[model samples]
Target: MARKASTRRRPRSGSSYRRVKKRSCYFCDSKISYVDYKDITLLRRYISDARAKIRGRRSTGNCQRHQNAVARAVKNAREMALLPYTNQ
Candidate 1:
């Protein structure tokens, strides 16, 4: 008598089985970095919907200190009108 071969199950359609990789913070890796509120271009990337919230360490791959700095800089930028208070 012949044995039947085992079949692997297929994943469901439109389902994603892989974990998405998190992005790293640009500043932390550079090391010579200092976050300045005055740098509008630099601060804009972190802002979402015209408000800045420090991205999670896993998401941005930034250390706690740098994330705090990013938040501070974003606030200052908003106050100074370098960045908008809310997205239009």
Candidate 2:
């Protein structure tokens, strides 16, 4: 089941990391309106290195619009055999 977007995960107990600052969207900064499915290098940055899953908005610092675009691009790339569905 998917967790609600409104609810946030609690910080780990006794962790060194504390509060995290919000990050600016990369697409907005670059002024890139379109996300290219063929851009493997660029798309790979948004994907998990180990699990091959898409990274959340918080992790990638992507805006909602761009994040959706990224996910679509990834799926297209996968269908084209340009990117592996899983790293393994």
Candidate 3:
């Protein structure tokens, strides 16, 4: 009598990175709200560390129009000392 071969499942190798859901822009999802330069707390979240630069649309998940608004707001806040021009 011939013996049958065993059936075994193989495990995956290498990276185990998980796919995350696409994030919506805070300003858009919340509502058609305006970006206020005086809102230091809100603006802080959009600024990058080390250089204190405004985050790009890709990372912020913002549309082009909103990104421009955010940039303008951040710049205004920086001029008013509400935010630092650069991280130091």
Q: Whole-model Cα lDDT per candidate?
A: 0.73, 0.95, 0.85
- Give lDDT for model 3: 0.85
What is the lDDT, from 0 to 100, of the residue 57 in candidate 2? 97
lDDT of 3 by residue, 13-39 (tens): 567855556668888888967998998
* Alpha-carbon lDDT of model 1: 0.73
* Predicted model with the maximum TM-score: 2
Tell me each candidate's RMSD, in Å, in order: 7.1, 9.4, 8.0
Question: Candidate 2, residues 1-88: lDDT per residue as tens digits?
Answer: 9976867687676768677789999999999999999999999999999989999999999999999999999999999999999987
Model 2 stretches with alpha carbons more than 4 Å out: 1-18
**Selected candidate, larger TM-score, 2 vs 3:** 2
Of 1 and 3, which scores higher on lDDT? 3
lDDT of 1 by residue, 1-88 (tens): 9989879887655656765777766776788378989988777667664444545567666777888898888878878888777655
TM-score, cand. 1:
0.63
Q: Which ten residues in a row have the lowest lDDT in candidate 3?
A: 11-20
Clash totals, every prediction: 0, 0, 0
- lDDT for 55 in candidate 1 is 50
